[model samples]
Target chain A: MILLFLSSGLFLGWSLGANDAANIFGTAVATRMVRFKTAAITSGFFVIAGAVLAGGGATRTLGQLGSVNAMAGAFMVALAAALAVLWMTRAGLPVSVSQAIVGGIIGWNLFTGSPTSIDSLVKIVSTWVICPLLSAVFAAGLYVLARAVTQRSRMHLLAEDAMTRAALMAVGAFGAFSLGANNISNVMGVFVSAIPASSVHLFGFLHVSSDQQLFALGGIAIAIGIFTYSYRVMITVGKGLFRLTPVTALVVILSESLVLFLFASESLEAWLISRGLPSIPLVPVSSSQAVIGAVVGIALVKGGRNLDLRLFRRIAGGWVATPIIAASIAFFGLFFLQNVFDLPVHRPVVYELSDAGIERLRERGVDDEGLAELGGVAFKSARGLTGVLREKTSLGMIDRDVVVDCARRERFVVTRKRIDTLDLKLLTVGQIRALRDITGQEFNYWWELESTLTRESDQWAMLPDTRDNHPANKKLRSNLRQLLDAFRTVDTDD
Target chain B: MANLFARTRLLESKIDEYLNHTSEVGLLFREAMKNFLDGRLDEFEERRGKVCDLENHADELRREVERQLYIETLIPESRGDVLGLLEQTDDVINHVKHALMQVSVENPDIPDELGESYLELADYGSRAVQELVMGVRAFFRNTAAVPDHAHKVAFWEKEADKVAERLKRRIFQLNIDLSHKIQLGDFVMHVDSIADQAEDVSERLSISTIKRSI
Candidate 1:
């Protein structure tokens, strides 16, 4: 059953490999600078390494966008996204899997009457525009520097060729790694919420979480796609698109890889924040758009002759059309799966304004006078609660979201059986002791369990979002999420 | 990576050796012409043999370089241009060898007044060939220097043309048999064609240099 639900995500991973691997290795293989076999093997290995190691940051962002809590719904979301990509690709329009997945998640939110986090949605949408622009800037600058070095060095032509070949291989590997790290989220992020919490011990030492295991599976699927299908796309990309010399191809690929890494690297983000600098948001961006932007950047550096306005228009059209198409597909697909197949597409989340929730809201500076009359009212969906909040209270969007989150009701009983099921390998000794201290407590909300754990031990507490504590805060959040996943129980009253 | 650079270095040296063979062929052709004009038949025959051997060796080296380039798939974008340049430069060497061989086969009885002029014409051809070799080498290392060497090749080829024309005019006015005059005139044209072949290679090198620029 788990395999059946994960099939769509695996398929999405395969398609991502088939299409995007070309953007990384196309020109090198096409120009005969690097052999196809070497390129495929190198990219395949690095991609898996990257997915297993650095894929979490972007997946967390996608979770914030809309957590697809039901396995069947997650399946439909991935299927809708894969279908949208296939449809758009057949139409010869540029499609981004990241955009399609976001749209599919939105579709699931609408179908299940869940509220999409507006902040996450805006951040992701803005990256779609900023990614390409950043790629162009990097490409232009790198091109000039590469050209100047080649000219000033006065190296023998054959020696330069050998050097360029080595550089292409190295850069292609980096590009593959970056692509896997950033884009794996689109393939398996929805399943993160759906899959139960577990950890696999490799060789009795290395602990691999359920999410990492899922990403590894997805990574293998991508590697299979590369070996079986990407050759054709790579050849076409080499010959079809802008006629790039091997050196120019190197520049374009390196620029695209840098952009992907910037968005996906948590260490880089931490380092930047530590230096009192703003950090780039970790979001998956389209490799194809990055390639196109790099090519355009080179063209602009060469005086901007023969610029294709029509292609740009098509890309812009795809940005709008792909999401809408995927959203529509997901909406209809979820309806059919629910009504026709008799599947539980969504697990209903009930919201209520109890006394404790109202007090929690009051502590957060939310005026509770307008909400006094609505106490003990149970709303079936997040949207239902949000509607009531807007009508009854003067809280803004952010405050309303906060109210909805705090009022979300769940039964969390810290029983020994549930505690035994927890992946203790993931938590510190202090955190484990804290969990044991509250082993018999019952709570009605996730925040209640969080508060108890925080009060019991400092290890479970989230520090201020300061530069020095960024990593700690991130780890604490991840630990908290795992605990919530373990303890969350269904309400039989529904 | 070390192996890649080693192969590149080996191919680079082979190309240099081939160019050196071309330059040597031109030098030997001039020496053979001078020996023939000075009535040193034995020395001329020795020089002619050496030119033939160098030309054959250069051909073998060129073929090996071309084979390595394809086998290793090195310099893929500029491979065609480099191959064309090497082949055309080989033609210049072949022209020098053929000119020397023709002088040996035809054994034209040159008048005393025309002997000096014939040696001068051979010197001009040798200079043209040397400049063309420099231009080809520059195409490999410094593209900016190719045009300068190409210009020198054209200048020497023009000089060879002048010497050939004057030698021909003097041959026609000689108080000797018309057959001998015509034969000497044919020899002048043959030696002059060597310089013409070098100029042709120089023209190709210039174009290749332009294509190689980023």
Candidate 2:
């Protein structure tokens, strides 16, 4: 029975992963902000980390699927939800995992007692509207702000590039962490609860329960989903999700996260209700919807509803269908799983340690600073070379303050580390560690020089020598010749 | 957590350092090219001197990246292509330096008819290639920003094409030797491609951009 919960979660998680992971990296991949391999690996690892660590914000809205008492209730919910998401994915639809879960729970509930968590459900639905709308407004505002700053400062594009790259990385990392804290639970919570106690393993440092294992499985399912089927969805989001600037993405994500955090708080929801606020109350709804709404808000501010209506409609449909069909199927399926199969009459589903909550435990030894840093946290790192660079470029630090800070603070402690340059991969790992993490953004630093440096350098080479007879010209030509010869060798690996 | 945090921070710094390094070189290249095409030989010389130190530093970095690119066994793993791109990009910088060096060495100006148009052509070609370079940058960067490539390339190329055509007609009408005409014509192709490559980059960018639509 416990194994069944584990397997079901594993199965469901894969589906959820397939459905949701696309939403995370789709736009980035589409924009070529990062490649599929890079995005997938980055998103995958972060999503799991987020799932196990920070997830469960607004996760309880999903606590309503005891809708049917049938033996097959759970199975039906899983199957239907999975099918809806799969079908949507096939059609290149931008569906919401949050909504799918909601719909499945509701579909089951409508037939069962239909007793839903009004407080949680209301909040979730409200977020559906608020997240996207606020995100758009936020993005629009940020874009305007960015334009104003750049124009006022008259900062060159080099300065701007340095600033934006660092900023994008930070924003992306925060989103990933928040996602783990919030969404991981959605992927893993139910199955963990379904498991009975005897087979579960508990400890001070870890809980190796069937549920926890299932969560990992769910994460894998998501990884697979992203690898195999996520490309189309990624494309849609990149081009179709929003006409984004890096700043716009930052604004939309931050706004959506803020709204989610607000609704996530029980006190805030009650206060909003008491104050008769126009916005919906504390429901953990679709973050994608929030993002979309935010994009729309920005569009209205900048371009207006004249924004492509065709793509918007297609996206919205996926958001609508995911939850409803998922709920209905879950309700009926679980009903059958229990009754028709004559499965053990386990106690009715309670909010037994939601699987999402369990994800918070992990590799341990993480401290306050780490946790804080993992969140939208910042720290200062002092260094020597940054000053060297700043002086050399004379480009303003206003754009790259964070980067400068990072360089200053994170001192590399090489203990007589005369390492092998031959093991370049090993060296790059060191380089990667020196710069930051495994996220692929750092790799692109070299790639960006094609126009900026290469063309400039080439032009320099071709220019008429002011000292017509200067020996430097001879040296430059020979140097170029050697470089060109080296280039032609193709196999020389530079 | 702080330890992992620290690792990423350190790595980020290193990456930024490398990127900034590339960017600096890029800026130098851009300035040098601009000065060269404008016949500012002195300015090109001043800038060209800065490359010795930076290129030495970059050579180390490039070699490391190339080794890694191979060791990781990445697909499209042609080092030649990478080096070719790098070399061609670098060559343009050197070419600008050399082209200016020649002008200063010979102080040779074309006949008045060709001289004006040559300067104009070089100017157009330089700006056109600059835009192409920008296009290439935007393509790789993937920000909301892209160069106003079409207009820049079209305007510059259009102008360069016009001047080159006139220069060709005049060279023949001037009754220059067939060999010299061929040499002048060859020079024109080089200049044209500079503009054309920048324009060509837009075509590449467009294809990549269309991939977004797909």
Candidate 3:
């Protein structure tokens, strides 16, 4: 059953590998600078390494957009995204898995009546534009530097060829690694919430979390896709669109890799925050768009004689068309899955402005007087509560989100069985002790359980979101989210 | 990695050696002509034999370099251009050898006044060939320098043409048989054709350099 549910995500992962691997290794293989076998093996190994190691950052951002929250719903969403990509690929239009998956999540949100976080959506959609533009800038700068070096060095032609070949291989590997890190979220991120949390001990020593295991499976699927299908795409990409010399190909790959790395690297973001610098958001971006941007960048550096405005318009059209198509497919697919197949597409969450929720909203500085009128009324969905919040109170979007979150009624019971299921290795001694102290307690909301734990132990409390405490706060939040997921009881009464 | 660089260096040296053979053929051709004009037939024959040997050696080296380039897939974008350059330059060497062989086969009796002019024509042909080799070398290392050497090749070829015309005019005015004058004129044209071949190679080198520029 687990395999059946995960098949759609694996298919999505396969398609992602088939299409995006070309952006990394196309010119090198087409030009015979690097053999296809070498490229495949190097990329396959590094992609898996990257997915297991650095995939968490982009996955977290995707989770923020919309948590699918049910296995069958995740299956339909991933299936919809995969079908959209396959249709676009057959139609010979530019398509992105990241965009399609975002649309699928939005479709799921609409069907389940979940309020999609506007802040997360805006951040993700903005990257669709910014990602390509940034790649163009990086490519242009690198081109100038490469040309200057080749000219000033006066190296023999054969020696330069040898060096360029080696550089292409090295950069191709880095590009593959970055691609795996950034785009794994698109392939397996929905399944992250649907799958139950567990950890496995490998070789009796190395600990592997459930999320890592899922990502690794997705990575293997991507590798299979690369091995089975990407060669033809790489060849076509080499012959298609812009004609790239080996050196120019190197520049394009490097620029694309850098952009993917900037968006997907958690450590880089953390390091930048530690130094008080602005950090780039971890988002999965389109590798194909990045490749096109890089090619255009080189064309511009060469005076823009080869710029094709028609092709650009077509690609932009795809960026708009792919998401809408994916969303529609997901919406209809979910309806069929629920009606015909009798599947539970969503674990419905209920909201209510109880006295405790009202007090919590007031503590958070919200004007709760208007919310008091709606107290004790159980809303069927977050959108329903949001609608009432807008009608009754003049609250802003962020505050409304806070109100909805605080008013969400999730019953978390602290029992010995649930406490035993927690990964003791991931929690501090204080946190485990606090869990033991609250073994018999029950709460009507996630935040109530969180507050009880904070009162019992400082380890359960989040630190101020300062530069020094950012990582700690992030870890605390993750730990708290895990505990919440572990102890929550499903409300089946609709 | 070191092996890759070492292989490239070896190929570079082999190409250098082939170009050297071409330049050496030009020098031997000029010396053989000088010896023939100075009435040293034995020395002329010896230099002619050496020119033939160098031409054969250059052909073998060029073939090896071409094979290595294709096998290793080096400079894929410019490989065709480089091969064309090498073959055209080799044609110049073959021209020198043919011109020398013609002089040996058609041992025409030369008037004393025309001997110095003939030597001067051979000098210009040799210089043109040398300049063309430099242009080809610059195409490989410093494309910016190729035009300079190509321009020098054209200059020397023009000088050879002028010397050939004057020698032919002087031969026609000589108090000799019409058959002999025409034969000497044919010899002068043959030697001047060597410089013409160099000019053609230089022209090709110029275009190749433009293509190779980043």
Candidate 4:
């Protein structure tokens, strides 16, 4: 029974991933700056991490309000909340998930003797009412900020790509992280209410157990959703809305995250509610709305009166229309995903990366975070300290930040073990060769080609023009710790 | 509640998938239109090639819907409505191709802005389709929900109006000969009608989504 609830929670999480993953890179994907796979893998990891870390608060709030008195009730509330939003999404309206769950909770509360806590409910409802308004106001302010900042560093970044690329990379990671923290709760919060702490476990010590299993379920479900349904939404979001410059995407994501985090906080929500103000805390709002609001804010700053009003009207209509319609369909949709037929199998995800491979990452020096994402994956997958480097060693590519993206597809770990290595980090060039003479990566063609092309005798570092160009190498989908561990041993520092 | 909730999530995913698929086709049409309007045969051929499989699958999907027929489409009226929307979805493809093919014959190098204009109309059409898809999903539960998107169809139709005006102005102001002028005028009209139909699809979609959702 516990397992059933957990899996159902996972299903919800997967759907959440599919829907909300779009929030992270919809514009970037739309503009063709990044691929959906890269966004999905990256988003999957950060969202899970965020849910496990920051997702607790939202889970608690949703669990408390939704009248999830039992495992069955939790499932119902979560399912209803998800169905309501998805129904709207399908119908083409973009209703906030937060709104649907809040509504569902209200409906459920009506049945119970909770007697409609008008005081608490009003504050929560008001947030929904006020958030978009606040978002718009904030968007207006952000537009001004964008204009001011653009003026400040206008010429410097026009030529210096290192600083610009670095900034873009940081912004992208930040956006991905924020998406995880805020959105995963939409999937797991209900399940979080029912799960007991005795059931689940994370990396040895990090025992989220059943106490936090719903969040984990939500995170994993979101991950699955990212793996399955999210690509299309990502395409629509990243590629569909408007063509975005990287800086524009950066600005929009930053603004969206800030605004969402501001709203998600319990303390802030309580404060607002106490003061007879509106707050949308503990509910699932549209990441689409927050991002779009921020984006339009950015766009208005760049091209004011010429701001595309037609696009605006159409989008506004979509937001209004998608939900009502989506709900109607989803209300019926509920009958379909469950009763009529069995669900499909979870497919293994394969990531594809375009033109810019690891060499460009090499061109820009690795930072601590970049190294961590890259190296962290390799080490985390390693065996204990007494006997290390015995498992498979593979090349986990670096990012602009130098960290390996931890969101690889189709991986499950069986046990928890800690491994630490000191020799690999301090290896000299001669020592690396002495080591590589026995154990090494099979970039042999890469080595041979680089040796043939370059005149310099001492150049061991090779940037292959077409080596990683086979349409799939843009993003590496290796085990996180394994990739990170392997990266630490690689002699890329030169 | 749990059973109902489960069904809702699945259906929403299914419908959203179809909506996304439709938009992809719309995107292809837009690309092909741009190429055709620019008289870029090579590019037109390239983008046009990508749609054959899409069109085939679209036909297949519709047939599957007809075959299954558990719940009826509220707006499609008859088999013909299904055929009409399908054809209209394909017409978006055909008109763009026809315009491009015509452009190749009359002016191998049509103005870039002409390509730009056609794409703008295509974009509006795509947006309308998306809204209609949303509305149709609404219709899945309730018919009244359709109007939410139906309202936007007018705005998109207004865009079609803008496209018509531009196509007319461009044709009227052109310095081409009478024979070529007539052919160009006919082609531009077809393009305008295409945009109009796309908007019509949105209108119908909103109606359908509303009906289904309710």
Candidate 1 segments whose C-alpha is farther than 4 A from its true place = A93-95, A306-309, A417-426, A491-494, B37-39, B109-124, B151-189
Candidate 3 or 2, higher TM-score = 3
The candidate scoring highest on TM-score is 3
Question: Chain A: TM-score in each candidate?
Answer: 0.96, 0.58, 0.96, 0.57
Q: DockQ (Cα-based) per candidate?
A: 0.61, 0.01, 0.62, 0.01
**How far in Å is the alpha carbon of A424 misplaced in model 2?**
53
Residue A71: error of model 4 in Å?
A: 2.2
For residues B29-94, could you state the per-residue lDDT of candidate 1 as single tens digits? 888998999899999999999988898899999999999888888888789989998999889888
| Local accuracy of candidate 2 as per-residue lDDT tens digits, A102-163 | 67666655544334445456666766766676666666676577656655554333333345
Candidate 4, superposed: residue stretches over 4 Å from native: A6-8, A111-114, A156-165, A197-204, A265-284, A299-494, B1-214
Least accurate stretch of 10 residues (summed lDDT) in model 2 chain A?
Answer: A409-418
| Displacement of the residue A420 alpha carbon in candidate 4, Å | 32
DockQ of 3: 0.62
lDDT head-to-head 2 vs 3, winner: 3
Candidate with the greatest lDDT versus the true structure: 3
Q: Model 4, range A263-284, lDDT digits (tens) per residue? A: 5555555566556665455544
TM-score-better candidate, 1 vs 4: 1
Q: What is the docking quality class of candidate 4?
A: incorrect
TM-score of chain B of each: 0.97, 0.57, 0.97, 0.68
Question: Candidate 4, A147: how far from true, in Å?
Answer: 3.0
